[model samples]
Target: MKKLIYCVLLISNVLLFNSCTDDKPIFIADLGSEKIAFTNNFASEYLLSKDTKNNIADRFIWNASILGVNSNYEVQAAIDEAFTKPVSIGVSKQTNITVLVSQLLELVDQLGLDEDPKTTDSTGKPNNSGVVYFRVKSKIGNGGAGTQEIISTTHMINIKLIEKVPTSTTCNPLWIVGDAIKNVGWNFSKTTVCDSDVQRVKVSLQNGKFRFFTAENNWATGLNFEYYKGKGYTIDARFKSEGAGDNNFDFIGTPGIYELVVDTSKKTIVLNPSGSFWAVGDATPGGWNFTGGETAIVETSPDIWQATFKFSAGVFRFFKTQGQWDINNNYAYYKNAGYTIDTKLENDGSGDANFKFVGTPGTYTVKINAIDKTIKLN
Candidate 1:
């Protein structure tokens, strides 16, 4: 009776195991009408510059799905419309990503971009600008047998290499036109000064939008360069020739006397608060616009740079580059502020240690000797 019961239980277990194994269905990954597409506003043009390498050039966002499959999205850019060998800008599991100036620079190289504005392509357009094609590539599953891939339709955007500074030192002056300035305002009647040689203008400016024009009041004629402070990057660039909306330099500075110096060649506009100099601080005319490329002195001789400016009673320092505070010459660097009005150099770092013009505040000649590391004032 015991052997009979054990045989019946074993037969039942075997029958159950066979039914479970044979009745199951084999599932396959179906990759039919699934697709990926961009779902964000794209800029009509992208401006790139070496100065703003740390800034975000553009933001790419897309929507993708593949039902039960996990999808990985990659943002890619190429000079060719048909991405023969696309360079991957970035990859993510999310739906969006920001491309940095450094990444765009890499694409610029692959596109054979020329920094020189004079260099032109076969179509007679400048090589400094070109069209860049971008797309999102989505993939599912592992890279084994059942790996699936889908590429979104390509999108093109005009890419321009911003001319941070002009290649040549040739000076091309521009006219000032904005509600901010007093005399020559945005109205076409009183728009410009009409003198091409008048590049720099000292005037009182309020909060408004301004642009540099080669021809008086007319934006379409020859070269009516507009200043852009760079949206996501540090690009001192001109506008896209469109005369509306974002085609003006939004003024953001101390509402005082300013010297509006426009470098039409470089597409840069510098509003020197007071005046520009190699060294500027609370004391100098270009008050604390420290990195605004305002050279204080002229190289009268080889190692000597001296010039005269109406300095107030405040400390000032020198900067190597405009709009950058890294490398500079401070009061402590002078070593000898002994003969100057203050007769002392602040014992602080680059931040506070500067030469202050004490006592009577008036126009004074400042002489700096780079070799001796000494400063003389008169």
Candidate 2:
């Protein structure tokens, strides 16, 4: 009986040792070959506006389930493709998220793409449009940065700001200096117009050359301006490339007393002829003048258009040409709101296509920006 008990104890101890040695370590999650990726295709371009701020810009979706673990998605945006400094636009526990225009605007503003038309990027493109890099940092938990995360492949999307005028605007004047003007030769103070605020001026220039300068006697390299794009300085075209090496506007046209206008809203400088954008209706003088320039909105600064007139409460619409009702610039073109600021910009498809001018009958300035696609009445 004693011998049998010893053998049983020795066998039991050996069995216990084998069981402990053979047991595997506690189960640790492994990513293995599983990875996260955006499933839905992204739009190549996104044009954002204040009117459609609530509208969804993009619905970012990705392949669901990471090792059957409940993970979170962090959407980030950066100016560069490498995402040097990323701004988290959204965080979602679900597999997808809807990003609003306002949300993207925040990123656009952060990226410095929402700047005024006067600003240009490093590549000389307007700051209003550029490529924004995006990526999804999926984390194993709902916690933010530094958590166990698996980042998805980066994708770039082009974003453009259509408008920036949320409030008041001031048109900065550009003096037509250089030896082109008959009397004023490179003297910025003999500026075509004495008042810096005045955008349009009649200056007499001899058959020579002239370039637009910012301030008095400031002949700095970048402070001057010339034609933008590859196009030459024609009768009526946008010409406002400031730092282009050869910045002289050769006045091959008839040299005499000509009206030079500096328009900031369209970033265009024009001579005499001013009627690119016009407002028409029974609300003002030259009521849809079967002719042009009667209710013409002149260019004050680069890309900024301005005009003032005595207005009565009535319906009006903007058009490129006079004599007919062609709906190019309508009330709905500015914003969907029935009214903006003080005027009633009634928005609809049917008969309310025109904007309603409200309030006291007096002189008011109308500012229109073609690039921004916005109108302001003040």
Candidate 3:
């Protein structure tokens, strides 16, 4: 019995020793070198035209390195060399990225460049060619754990602005009236004239063609505009009506809502494919009249629409387009009482759930962010 007890004690000691040796060593990655180099494809100047499809821009290439254990790469552009206001251009695993002319122009606009070509920089330098700086950031791990970010040297990029807007100006095209439009019957006066604020209008049409007009009723459709077929949303092949020509826009596809954003200063038009999101029901100001004032949600921002209308003590639901029940309808509601900021509401397929206003009837605000797929009620 003494020998058996001795063998059991020896086995327990061996088991404990093996358990202590089982853990693997934690590996810490290197923070990598501070310096990074870009490849030969980098250019000093890039010409940005309105139509960037046919034009080939600059493709930035760089050498890849093991910055850390799991190194990821991102590119950023900024107006200032110090990167005070940086805009992320691209983030990817690849070491190369093609900076499109359209993207470069967008970055320039976001950097608060003025519309006039003769605009000056802060240092009294002529900024006719919008100069921007690009750099690359190589990062490891997810910043929460073992992570390090290494930035590359700033590269100069002078964006040459072509297709400058002509000095001539025309009146704002408020409503699109034509036979191709679903409700409009080519009669401007009796037709439901689409309104515009800040030279932008949200137009919903079937698979048809239409033309823009300045007046709400009758007379003549002045300063009409037409889009090229292969131009996509950019106004590359835009043809404006000088006098006698009719420039009709052919919208052939699924019948949905679209937003026509016109920049008179730049002489550019962006017809974006968008959702016809709005609210309508007894709780809304227009009540059941979906096509009238209650359902007309204004675009407060790009793809973010809001309206401050009077709501009655009732319930309402959101839809992409009014009167098209089977089309783009979101038949769901916010659970509990209502939704706060950035609250994502669910779509109930064919369910009849709706948002209710339990408080007294007065002026209220409803906002729908189609880009983020969220709603806000105030």
TM-score to native of every candidate shown: 0.43, 0.39, 0.35
Residue 152 in model 3: lDDT? 85
Instruction: Score candidate 2 by TM-score against the native.
Output: 0.39
Among these predictions, the greatest lDDT belongs to 2
Error of 2 at 199 (Å): 24
Cα miss at 238, model 2 (Å)? 25
Candidate 1, overall lDDT? 0.63
Off by over 4 Å in 2: 1-30, 140-148, 163-378
Q: Per-residue lDDT for 1-378 in model 2, tens only?
A: 999999999999999999999897876456555578887656657888877787656577787655544556788878787888888878888777767788788777777775476778898877787678878876553243423667888888788888454443455556667676777776665444433333577666566666766666667632334333343323343233324465676666665555686544455557874344678876777665546535877665444578989887667777665544444366764565332433444443443366776667778888876546567777
Report the lDDT of model 2 for residue 344.
40
lDDT, model 2: 0.65
Per-model lDDT:
0.63, 0.65, 0.60
True-structure RMSD, every candidate: 17.1, 16.8, 16.0
lDDT of 3 at 177: 69
Return the number of clashes found in candidate 2.
Answer: 14
Instruction: Using lDDT as the measure, name the better of candidate 1 and candidate 3.
Output: 1
Candidate 3 clashes between residue pairs 3 or more apart in a chain or in different chains: 188-217, 189-217, 276-320
Indicate the worst ten consecutive residues by lDDT in candidate 1. Answer: 231-240
Candidate 2 residue-wise lDDT at 265 = 43
User: lDDT, candidate 1, residue 161?
Assistant: 93
Clashes of each: 7, 14, 3
Candidate 1: TM-score? 0.43
